[model samples]
Target: MTADKKSITALIIDDDQMVADMLGQILQDAGLNTIITFDGKSAIKLYLDKKPDIIFSDFLMPEINGVMVLKAIKALNAKIPIVLFTGYYNQLMDELKGEIVKPDRILRKPFIQVEKIHDLIREFFPGYEIDA
Candidate 1:
């Protein structure tokens, strides 16, 4: 489906409340609907219920990590685009090697720009154009 025709729903998962709120705001500003979860455990339940078009999850969480979250979501919908965000990008990438469930993208922490978020949406949902 074309991006214009596709419904953009984003699931933002991060243990840090501030980070989740920031990402949610960015997605909202980009004209996409979003659901924010502070933990991976709840995120899985939310994912099942909401079935968002894309997901942004922090690699490190209290109990279930981002990789685990991705696996759980993949079990339900393998095609969903999941981006793993972490401060320790290199460490997480190294840990994810040889893993069956992999993230579609990796985002570094302290995400600075809304444009990067838009780019991610545009990447997954082709034809998506930001409204001025």
Candidate 2:
């Protein structure tokens, strides 16, 4: 079944408030509802409660990390798309090598290209219209 465009939601987990807000705005511009959390623990809780259509999460955090978040969410909903964000992309990739549970995508920090966020929304939720 196709997701109702208006009902589409995105869960954003980032310790950096600025990055979280930036990502939230990008998703909102793509016509998505967004839930932002500063930690992976709260993110998992939000995931169960909201069941967002997609997820964008930071790779490093206290208590739980992106891999933990990815594995936890994937266990419940494998079909949901999840992207990981990190400043240490190469290291994270090396660490994830051979891992069964992995993010659908990994993005590097200093998000200069706003289009990447729009592209992700388009890739995962093609029905949603992105604002130019």
RMSD to truth, every model: 1.6, 1.4
* TM-score, one value per model: 0.93, 0.93
Question: How many collisions per candidate?
Answer: 0, 0
Q: Relative to the unseen true structure, what is the C-alpha lDDT of residue 44 in candidate 2, on a scale of 0 to 100?
A: 95
Evaluate all candidate structures by whole-model CA lDDT and list the values in order.
0.88, 0.88
lDDT, candidate 1, 16-109, per-residue tens: 9999998988888777888999999999999889889999999999889999999999998999999999999888989899998889999898
Clashing pairs in 2: none
Whole-model lDDT, model 1 = 0.88
The whole-model C-alpha lDDT of candidate 2 against the native structure comes to 0.88
Candidate 2: residue 31 lDDT (0-100): 73
